[model samples]
Target: MQWYLCALTALLLATGCKKTTCECPPKTDDPKMEYTELNDKAVGFNSSYSLDLNKDGEADFSFSTLLVGDPVLRRDYRQYYIVSKFYTNCLVNGNEETPVLQKGDKIGSLPPEGFHWYNASHVVIAQKIIEENGTSWSGNWKQVAHAYQPVSILKGDKTYYGWIELSFDMQSEKIILHRAAVAKDPNVEVKAGG
Candidate 1:
């Protein structure tokens, strides 16, 4: 068709006059950000990792691990908790479990199909239940490396989306946090570590 010639001509022109910036996604983001490098932290057995999600110098969420025993039920529970001091939410599939997202994956306020933004102050993740019969796990974070957790922070009148990179030590039920980042714009999707 005659349209093919026009398309070819347009493509040639675009190639001939290439701009300084390419139209493809960048390999890495150089965010003009305050929280560029995250502090290395771990929480286990009553100690908590207090987080300042927006890098505003105020603690927004506190993460801790707890071990509980129920003598009557002959079971023990090791749980990870995220307690928010402000309005904060995390991604979950409604099974009390947050998925382990990889690098470059999108972190958004609205989750895909089965997942949802967990709208609560206290969220229990990576729950490990031990019983005489066997041991079972919940919340996914066990043994994962460089994993990302999708998060949302609602401060004042706006909601900011972000992500936190984490790793879990199942032996000690410790949660190791490596990095955290927030999108420059409110309510926009951010790459896991960008």
Candidate 2:
């Protein structure tokens, strides 16, 4: 009985001392994802691009810019003018709408009441040219107007943050997207002027 008891105790000790492997998998660093700089020209009066900031198969962000037009003139006189607008994939529609202002709306200005209920999910950030002809416009030139302000966008259940800077050169007939920053997830916040 003494021998059996000693053997049982040894077996229990050996079993307890055995190395156990953890079931959890090893953690790896996430892929290095960063914003991409884009320099594109507007097809007509507008240009759009779908961005996948996280390298995910699906597009996470979309940006569109339209030249603001005068309601009275019914046209955009400034060839280089652009108002950068950011949107999620959900808000974009296949149908076309007039880019100019309608009744009760102001020219070269967003709706005073803010985005309509249908467009509540969309966010707008304006960038005007700060300098022109090697001198500050003194708020005169709308072509280069730009404000590097951060705007929050709510799409579906997630909220994203980003900033955009738009510059157009009439001489070159090009619209330059100087900076764009979009968050991959709601928890992560993007800095301004990205």
Candidate 3:
């Protein structure tokens, strides 16, 4: 009886010392398993901006647009593409600042690149907003955006329009991307694209 008790105690100790086995499976970095949603209640604002004129302090006029297109999923198994256009208007604030306006140029195939940082100024951080799909299915959204700069300013009035494109797998669920672009000249009257 004493020998049997010793053996049982050793067996229990050995069992306890063994490594724990995962019940479900090792955690995977699966994009499909991850669902990200954009927070509709979130507010977006720009902090770093420049005044166009030497005197006026307030932003007379400013606006920006973020265009998200449907995913063009084809050929490439599970890949997706997102194309966005960032447009903004900067109006002269000073009384004497009568400005001439010019239409933005459309450079056929590709837009300009390399001179500026893609996404640096805007803040689109979210605490993770969730949405439900009926009883069993659900989907998520993420706010992905880009800050654009005016291509050319002829007179006093300047309008900026830029393009930003992003591609990712389902793993890019709800990834928040913010952008901000500082004018090259600090003193020049500057306004961020909306």
Candidate 4:
């Protein structure tokens, strides 16, 4: 009975996606590509966007917002971050923050000198910290708009690549997720937004 239920669930999920084949840039269409249409979804305080790169039930990564207050310090801190999940990594370096990438960038192995795959859990996109002295802003996504970031998923010894298109604004403290795509083929470099 358990085996029958598992097969049924898998069949439903396989047909749940409305679109499968990707018709991206000319000659870049990949039938094995999986795309998720978020359509400018805004994730802010108390809200988060869970991304399942391979249509699996588990979350590969997620974008979230957190706000904490310290009465003793008389300040509040609001932060935005992308949390890397199990076997998932973000493109980062010694700086610890993922760099804002341009669209169509190649995400492959042995990335540039200062760039490599790292499991950057709780990667700050932006942070608004208010102290008694004053309010200060920090992080690479403070003023970013329509930026691309690389995400890698490790399965066994193979790695799959993907990208997410998003925007973050300090004024609204919101992270807008436009879309995400993943290449089903392992070790294949996937172009951002393609």
Candidate 5:
């Protein structure tokens, strides 16, 4: 009786067993590039606009790419080393050194009402039309460049989570930059300059 009971249990267990398989996505060998710093070191600024000081519905920075960098996203793309701007009063230390703007550097105070564009310790007003006759591209998104305010230091991690958006408009011939609210670990700052 005992032997029969043991044999029956063994048979039932064998029939009820099912093979387990693991499904894992394939890992690519491609490297993940780190973001570079955007201080005076790894960045460059160049202004091409001619001033239309009268503001007759015209821009001052005109007819050229103000600043270009390695495409913002790529598997091999490295982080920016320094925050560089092509517009005047964009760089903190006049673009003379690397990492011109450091962490904890107090940017200027916000304006009383509308858009308050600024840099560290600078209340930036538009000096020239960075681009009057701007470039045009097609699609739902277009690219154009114009001078409005100076510029400010923006963290890189702030970019991925939709903190900053850079787009262009072909129909309007304008490059649009929108700054969004940031919520991230302050310790994970990207030092730009590479």
Candidate 6:
């Protein structure tokens, strides 16, 4: 009886101490709304625009694309990078005049209250440039540069957290964004779809 009691206590303790793990469902798109695609016409040197990513007819974020020349080369040629800015008002229109970053402008400073920029080192997503007959395509979702990272967007009073991926095609001059809304509180249960 003594041995049986000891065995039962050990089994109970083992079972009680087992850790419970939560499995989150994979991200899926909402069939009702389509993903936004910005083509070459919409992007250019010093071009800026407000994007309605979730298709709610409201601009959730804004972006500025800049073309900078190589310092050492000092040629007329330039490379492109994007600066992303968040908006508190969903209906905020883009600034009339798009601002361009100069060669000496600071590129690594923390973004202002509502803005963030991506440079060579800290790209938000993997980028692929597909070319066909001298035309470029930058909206491929299959090619992910790096694993998804957590990002939070504050709209009004609530802050939404999620994973985001961005892709740009240099030749085609397009930007593709993929986002999945996660739980507001990371520790809480995450719903299946964003």
Using TM-score as the measure, the top candidate is 4
Instruction: Sort by lDDT, best first.
Output: 4, 1, 2, 6, 5, 3
RMSD of 1: 8.7
Misplaced by over 4 Å in model 4 are 1-32, 68-75
Residue lDDT tens for model 3, 1-194: 99999999999999889887779867842211111122221222221122222113443222222322334521111111121113222222222111221222221112323223122123211222222331121111123233222322222344223211111112333222233233333223323231
Worst 10 residues of 6 by lDDT: 89-98
lDDT by residue (117-161, candidate 2, tens digit) is 123223332223322233222111234534342333455667554
All candidates' lDDT scores?
0.74, 0.40, 0.27, 0.83, 0.28, 0.36
TM-score of every model versus the real structure: 0.74, 0.37, 0.21, 0.77, 0.24, 0.34
Model 1's number of clashes is: 0
Model 3: worst 10 consecutive residues (lDDT sum): 74-83
- Cand. 1 Cα-lDDT: 0.74
Residues 13-55, candidate 5: write the lDDT tens digits: 9988978786987775322223222122111123222322122
Q: Write the per-residue lDDT of candidate 6 for residues 62-174, one digit (tens) a residue.
A: 54454434456443322233333443211111221112222222211232234443212222121333233332222222233322322334556554433333444454544
lDDT (10s digit) by residue, model 1, range 46-146? 78877786777877667887888999999999888776554787766756666678887877755766888766656676778999999987766767777
Model 5 lDDT at residue 86: 31
Where in model 5 is the C-alpha error above 4 Å?
A: 1-163, 174-183, 190-194
TM-score of 4: 0.77
Clashing pairs in 1: none
Best by the lDDT measure: 4
Per-residue lDDT for 1-194 in model 4, tens only? 99999999999988995677876766745536688888999998888889887887899999988888989889998888899976999877677778787887777786756867777477877889989788998888888899887888888999888889999877777999998888889988777777
| Order of candidate numbers by TM-score, starting with the best | 4, 1, 2, 6, 5, 3
